[model samples]
Target: MDCLAGSARAVPRWRNVAGASRTGKPVIVPGLIVANVAVFVLTVVTAGSLNRNFASPWFAEGALVPALVANGEYWRIVTSGFLHVGPLHLAFNMFALWIIGREVETVLGRARFVAVYGVSLLGGAAAVMLLSNPLGPTAGASGAVFGLMGALFVLLRRLKLPAGQVIGVIALNVVISFTIPQISWQGHLGGLVFGAAVTAALVYPGAVAQNRRRVQIVAISGLALLGLLLIGAGAAFL
Candidate 1:
């Protein structure tokens, strides 16, 4: 039920051609990179300081603060994925995205790649709402970047590619997530798990015969609903 299952079974001649073309160009990845960078530039231009912008209205409005989200700022879940606290943060996340995102986008294609990223972003926001400080704000693309890592991990393994490097990167990032101050380990963990789940659903063998597009839509919708529920619960409990 993998996205590439049909392609994998193609005749040898076609397989080589497909492989070459698949790796040749990725449309969504570049657009995503550009969008993230553009948003960061806007944030920096408006906020004046890369490292400290909590005082900036964009940060205040876009960052995932449980209290604000609970009070009806639901858009933060998506917007926060585009905002970064500093250049270092943006650079690290965008770099990871550039390296990993292009590969994943190539494999998943544009639409599915977008779905995985959106789910990962919402999943991270849900984790922040549920487990992070209700009053503190969290912002970055790390969550969605981590999500891409999870999806890539599954994808590489499925293709019989060496996934040791992916596993190693995830392990290293997990360690950093816990040790780094102000980092949202919850968001990272949430995005990783959610991304894996979503990707698995997307590539499920049973879905190969079914309407794959419909399946992807359902899976993404379910994830989005779950994220909303988590946000509601967080608001209620925390």
Candidate 2:
């Protein structure tokens, strides 16, 4: 699956859109970008080519292959998200992550943002395992980036900000996913669905302000469990 689907325009600053003070500076977003870049560099060094990192042993070990996952190499679901096919793929995905991830991190705080990102990555892998060719290897952060995009849309709607641009961007990406060969629409759609659902749980915890945190905990836990169940079921299919 191609990691760099396209450039998804960044959302306007939350403070500008929602008139709320900034909650936190972005810590996790930068860290994630660095991690992805570092992994890409290592893949290039090992493979001795910028565009052919797939030839690297790192790719062999990390890229998600459903048959291997079924054989119990379960860590591919996480590592594959960090691997990329080429420099261009890595660049585009990191750019999208910087643009979209920082805003989501600022709004959700570190712990919650990490939770959503981790689960969304797994959700994407689960979809791939369940639907894509069992022997084909897939890698990249597109799925997680798509997840962040989905989260950003939910956040904008929650703040009552104009979401026309976000909706258009998402629609455009969905179109690209279908038109472009080698793109994993299954992973993209899975991440989007799970990310939006997880963010909705966080932002829409019902009445009773004092119990909002408690409600968020329950909701996020439930979603995480659901993601795990999906992953396990996908493995069974593999």
Summarize candidate 1's per-residue lDDT along 34-62 as a digit string, tens digits.
Answer: 98888888887778877765457877788
lDDT of 1: 0.79
Residues 1-238, candidate 2, lDDT per residue (tens digit)? 0111111122344322222234446788999999999999999999998889889999899998989988999899899999998988899889989988887776776777887798788778878888899898889998888898899888878766677888888999999989999888988888888888888887777846567778878877888788778878888876
Instruction: Give the winner by lDDT.
Output: 2
Compute each candidate's TM-score over C-alphas.
Answer: 0.87, 0.89
Pairs of colliding residues, candidate 2? none
Q: lDDT (CA) for every model shown?
A: 0.79, 0.80
List clash counts for every candidate, in order. Answer: 1, 0
The number of residue pairs in model 2 that clash at the backbone is 0
